[model samples]
Target: MPDPTQPRKDTRGNILFFFGVLILLLLAYHLAKELEILYVSALFAVVLMPVLHRITSWSIRGYHPSRAIAIVLLLLAAALGLILFFTIGLPPVLNDLRGFMTDLPGRIPGAVDRLKHIPLADKLGVETIASRAENTAAALGSYIFTSLPDWLTHVFDILTTIFLCIYFMLEGEHAYEFFLSLFRPPARQRLDATLRKAELKMSKWLLGQGLLMLTLGVCSLTAFGILHVRYFVLLGVLMGLFNIIPVAGGVITIAMAAGVAAIDSWQKMFGVLIFYLIYVNLENAILTPRIMRSSVNLMGLTVLVALLLGTALGGIVGALVAVPTAALISVLLEEYAVQRPSQS
Candidate 1:
């Protein structure tokens, strides 16, 4: 008979469990690092699951769509959107851009002349800017030409991700089932429930983010209008679009706004900076936490670290999926790793 106080050992099972955990970590890291296109595609598929399910289930002319037909319809809708954008949106933007470029040379000297009157402009070598501008423009042009190959590579990766997303959307249910099969029946039930929770949270995030983007865009447009900022519409549009990427997005928009403002006057530039500073603080402190309430439960530090790690792993796509990925990881950790108080 075994002693009542003695603990039972399961050495072989423990060793196997350790190895399984190690392998999973290695596999996750490898996917995040090397095969980010597929990784992001999978994440995209998860996010689009609700939409796909709805579309597939909905009847048009008394006919429900097959998975392939649903996938094709989604792709076609996306293609239609691009076609509309090119036909409707691109011309006006191109015209404005062409007008801006035509006026740029004349505007530069005026800007430089105005800069000469500014405080400490002499000390800052403002006079040298005009001389350097031409060389700088040439260098920028050369850099853009040289970077074409890299740009094309990026485009290729985006196309591959899109293609993979289509496939994932079609067979995502099967893939999800296969994932569930990796565990015992009880474990599968738990995991299935956890993933559903994550999916709901991610869906909420999509809605919340869209609302935030719209609000920010409207605010940007109003602020720029009040300040009589040039290219206000384009800048506002950019602000809204970039705001999708979280922290890094704000920085890029701020820089662009500041540069555009500087072209007119330092006072306008300062005003733009002040507006952004106030807006960023307000959004971060108020809007973001409230809007992203579901994700806020993950803690600020975890989200920041996730963004950093994801960016390090796979650039923009990683960053795009970072918050959801972190949320999913948090769900797993809470379900398994975290110990809870037992009710008496």
Candidate 2:
């Protein structure tokens, strides 16, 4: 009645606008899916950036950075090769693992018997404790054997990650520049600041983490060797690698070590547990504070939140990236808040 043709045009425009938004959202989702690989690759580069920087700088004095990087890669390959060789070829290591699993249930009652003779058993119900420990060991053994196949499948993913990491190391700078050029000047400046903050945070976190792992591994290996634990080297290496994960990793490593030690003697099992507890405390109180304070200044609550969110989104890899990503977000948001007030 008022203007039928004008109403029709308005409806058409609305429909087109909604459709365009839908298309854009679909494109964005697809891009995000593809970006997972790129994100992982970038993380690897960030972890290695400190080493890369040192190598590149040294190379500017006549040595080739490419060659230096190649050497570093070669060394890494050799280390991995050695680990594989030991894990595969060493009969004692295999035998120890098999024996530990097969005898764990039997060992628990023996430990309880020994515990009953101790002074504290009369004060606390030792029999109940022993029963629980035995049940837990059996459950753990069953879980490990059940999950082994799935764990093996993850090896393929590891290989893919390694390849992507190598590619990123080779092409990271060029890729960064290309990405920056895609944005307008103001946006590019903001993006560059975000990237730098993230990169620095990630690099420092990873390097500090690596050093912490090395320290813990060495200390653990020394303790094991002193106790004459079977497959000390293998156990140490496993602990070191798993230590990359934050809270859960130490617990898992200690539990496994204790279970394995139980096959020998309860005294040894208890010793391993005590040692790990002490080491974890030392790491948390001394080493982590000293190393990570400058890099990741987030409070414990923030870290926990980031970890939970990361685990929800992408599993272990996501968890690894979550802290730095949150830190970057925090930095950008703070900057934006300050700048907005000034602009107003």
Candidate 3:
């Protein structure tokens, strides 16, 4: 109690500063949560800049492209990509679907016969396997049908992300400079360098990812075609597209492919499985390491951790940008903590 006589130390300054910092942190976290779309747009813009830069450097019939012309050409390229996807990927899938529906009734009796052969199935007094399968199928159908609305929202979000990305690509320089202006000169310079490094790495991922997809697509296509598998083109393209999703995607697509193969015969199914087993091992041992070394340059554990953290922080969008974000954080830590370059 006697300490009160020693000039009551005004704690206002320290209290105010602490509260200010807390407010800033809370604001940053809230903004991150609310503006995920904007962040994702910025990420896509960075990844696509290399492609845009290359396109901008091209000439139209020996005439240099103006900014508008470059934009036109970029849009055209996007259109071409969509056109190819619909033409090459969608038709075979549709054909397979139609054929499956047409043949499903005829295939039912055979499926039932096979199920009836299951040992002890009758001894346990179980219902027909066909009935069990039908019930499972009905439940799955009900779930899917119920989720259509959510899927539509997801598709809308994707389209919006694309639109935002294009807008950012077209006119992001001003905004970028505005962001840089928030920091001091030295801090801004370091930030610019770190961001540039991140951009380059992300661009490399775009190229490497495309290469991996193409490799898988071609290999799967050729192998499935040789095996006379139904929906070979469809399955191949699906495998390629699914690779963007990492671990679970490949497994899901391969399982679907195997299911389709089983419709022909267990021999074809086993052959397909064997091929994928060898291919996955080869990819893990040889393909991914060689191709990604110059690109992402991340260890397997780093990637896994990045993905987990990103997913936790940003959901699907976070997972999408995880590797590049990790790369950016690594660059910052290196520049500041490891290198400690002399400040000018």
- Assess every candidate by TM-score: 0.77, 0.73, 0.77
Local error of candidate 3 at 224, Å?
1.6
Q: Candidate 1 or 2, higher lDDT? A: 1
Candidate 3 structure quality by residue, lDDT tens digits, 1-344:
57874453557666788999999989888787447888788887887777777777887789776656666778798899989979876888778656654554455556556546788667654446556655665465457668989888778767788888888888888888999999999999989988888778777876687787888888998999999988787788888887765665678889988877877787888889998999899988898888777667778788789888887887777777777777777777777778444754
Tens digits of lDDT, candidate 1, 164-257: 8888887778888998999999989998998888777776676677788888888887898799888777777778888877777878997988
Q: With candidate 1 superimposed using the best TM-score fit, by how many Å does residue 159's alpha carbon deviate from the native?
A: 2.0
Give the Å error, residue 32, model 2.
8.0
lDDT of 2 by residue, 10-79 (tens): 9999999999999998987878644666677678777776676665666555866663476476558768
Number of clashes found in candidate 2:
0
Alpha-carbon runs more than 4 Å astray in model 2 = 1-35, 59-61, 67-93, 112-152, 229-231, 258-270, 337-344
Q: Which stretches of candidate 1 lie above 4 Å from their native place? A: 1-34, 57-63, 92-138, 218-226, 274-290
Question: Which one is best on lDDT?
Answer: 1
